[model samples]
Target: MRITIANHKGGAGKTTATVNLAAALAELDKRVLVVDMDPQANASRRLARPFDRDAPQLTASEVVRSGEEGVAAQAIAPSGWPSPYTELVSVLPARFDLDNRVSEAGTVGAVGRLRRALQGVDDEYDYTLIDAQPSLGHLTQMAFAASQRVLVVVEPEYDSVEGALRVRDFVKGYAQDLGQPDLRVLAYLVNRARRVGEHAFQLEGLADRLEGDVWTPHIPEWTAAKDAASSALPLQICGSARGPEMATLWTELAKQIIVEGAA
Candidate 1:
């Protein structure tokens, strides 16, 4: 299954979810690769940087900008997580240069270029998660074109929810214009939701408004999540605050993706 985790607004926990879910899937013996399409390279720093700072990188920018040549083969790198997770999880790191080259590289055939690039490694992993930049731009469109499903992560805030809704609507036009009419947001996930009454109300309201498309077991607000980001650890692997919750949530999300892929 190829899934794109996106949010047009920053600080919505897209990268956090990607790394944790990728770790969960990897623990399940599902070979996984996280394709960090975001030029911010935060995911790259968290998952890819800790392993090897000295190795030459093979970022997503190079693959997508390679045109028809299919350079994704060279872009794959092990996440270097130790023990059981070591070989199972890998990353396609990104760098600052990706952001710089976006204007020139994201032109005609941008979607096709990404599709072809990913096709080179399609058979190597059972699950591929594309972490999109926070926008409705060509990079995100290319991610949608390459993915079987979209996972939109939103925090339980007025502005974050609003941004997510706008992205939900934008995907429709993006799919049509990019020739991916079948593309759709398979899951709408609420992230970092506090256990307060107001937050609960907002989540319930979002579910009602979206006709029950909201995913089960929304991620709870936890300091461990922030710690994981800083320590370069997947939330599931942290084995600290809310670790079990993160583990189970991602496991269930992975199950949903498996069901969809089977369908």
Candidate 2:
């Protein structure tokens, strides 16, 4: 399965969800591929080995720019994690130069470039998770066009909720136009949630608005998430006090994704 973790709202934890979920999926003995489509390259930094990015090498930018079949294979590299996890996960890193793809979005067949670049390449992994840039622009469109499903991450705030809704509507309205009629938002994941009044209100509102599409056991506002990112480690292996708890949440989410993908 190819899933894109997306939200137009910055600081909504999209990259956090993508890398940790890849870790959780690897724990289940699944081979995972992470594609970083953000110009910020946050996901690339977290998931890629230091040496991989130390020197110039092929990246997602080249993959999309070339739009050649099976070219993504050349960009794939081992994840930064040690041991078993590193063996199970791979990354297609991106850099700041990925932003250049935006200017080429108006060219003919631009939206399909990524899908074409990734052709026959995903067969090596059980799941491919794409960390899209925090926008609904051309870059994100390329990610969506290549994905089979989208996982929208949001914080419990007005702008985040509105951004999630906009992502839902964008996929619903444009999937067919983009040549992927089966594309859809698989679920809405609430991140950085708390037991406060505002968060409770937003959670309730989201349930009422998006109905069954909202996922259960909302992710809590845990410092471990930030610590893991800072250490460039997966929550499953970050060794923080709450790391296991956070990893459990992601494991559940990964299982849910597995079930949904199988269905």
Candidate 3:
């Protein structure tokens, strides 16, 4: 199964969700491959050594742009954290230079390149999690094309809610433009939800508006998330007070993604 976690707005917890969930799934002994489709390279830096200093070939750009010419042999070094039980989870690193390549691809075939590149490799792993850039650009569209389920991460706020809707529409419209009539919305995850008035109020409104597509179990704000990043450790190894809460979110999310086959 291919799950693409995306949000057009920044700070919606897209990268955090991508890293943690991929770790959680891998912990369950599932072979997972995380494709860092974002040029920010946040995921790559978090999960691997500080990227090749002068080698532009150390990224998915080599595969996506070169048609898998050098993908199979790329060695994905772990981030020095505890390995997930699978020990099979790997990340296709990215770098800032990928932004230039993405820009150079323009609008025409840019979105389709990723899909074509991952074609035969999809079956190699049990799950593929793509962390997309925070924009409705060609790369994001390509992620939508490559994923079987599109998981939208939205914070409980007016702007975030509005951006989520735009992202949902982008997936629908882009599929229509590409003549793909079977695209699906897996669910809208409410990230950083709080046990407060406005958060609950907004969630209620969004629930009514989005209806069945919204995933009820929302993730609460946790300080350990920050600590984990600062310590250069995955949340799975943090064991902070909020660890149980985050674990609950991941377990629920895994059930939603794996058991239900939401795609």
Candidate 4:
């Protein structure tokens, strides 16, 4: 399955959700490929790889910009974690140069270029997860273009919820244009949820608005989440802020993805 995690606005815990979810899937013995489309390279950095031309050769930019011929296995790298099978988790790293290239193209259709490139190897993994750039630019569009499902990560804030709604509308419209008429939100993951009553109220409001589409289990604001990011480790393996909660959430997430055929 191909799933894109996107938000028009940043600070919604997009990268954090992507990494931890993918890591959770990996823990289930599923082969997962994470494509880091953000020029900021937070996902790549979290995976312990530099996001620069000097870092590695199989980057998303090279794979997409090189056209059809560029779609090869070399673009993905193992996370270097101590998993029994390192091959279970792979990453298609990106660099800051992606921003410059996309800007020079005059339009963002090239953003969906990653989706076009993915056609070359459709059966290599159990799931393909994309950590999209914050803006609804080419990169984010491409992720939507290539995906059969979308996971909108939203923080418990006004702007985050607002941005998620806009992006949800955009994905609906774009999927129609692409002939994916059945596209539906796989899940709306509430990330960094606080224990404050105000935050709970906001979350309840958002949940009511989104209804059955929302994931009931929310991922709380765990310090280990930050610690894992800084230490370049998957939260499941490196830290213990909310270990039991994370374990249950990921298990539910995996079950949802599997049942929905999103993985």
Best by TM-score: 2
| Candidate 1 vs. true structure, TM-score | 0.91
**TM-scores for candidates 1 onward, in order:** 0.91, 0.97, 0.88, 0.90
Better of 1 and 3 by lDDT: 1
CA-only RMSD, every prediction: 2.1, 1.3, 2.6, 2.4
Candidate 1, residues 169-222, lDDT tens digits: the string is 877767777667877878788898998877877786796664427877788878
* Residue-wise C-alpha lDDT for candidate 3, range 1-263, written one tens digit per residue: 87788888988988888877777777666777788888888877666544776764457766666544234345344344555532666777777666765665564666666666777665777888899888887677777777777788999988888878888887777776643456667788888988888888888868667543777678888897776656545666666777656766776787677876633
lDDT: which candidate is best? 2
Q: If both were scored by lDDT, which would come out higher, candidate 1 or candidate 4? A: 1
lDDT of model 2, residue 193: 97
What TM-score would you give candidate 2 relative to the actual structure? 0.97
Q: Residue 160 of model 2: what lDDT?
A: 93
Runs in model 2 deviating more than 4 A are: 50-54
**Which sections of candidate 4 miss by over 4 Å?**
52-55, 69-72, 104-111, 178-180
State the lDDT at 121 in candidate 4.
Answer: 66
Better of 2 and 3 by lDDT: 2
Residue 111, model 2: Cα distance from true site in angstroms: 0.9
Q: Give the clashing pairs for model 3.
A: none
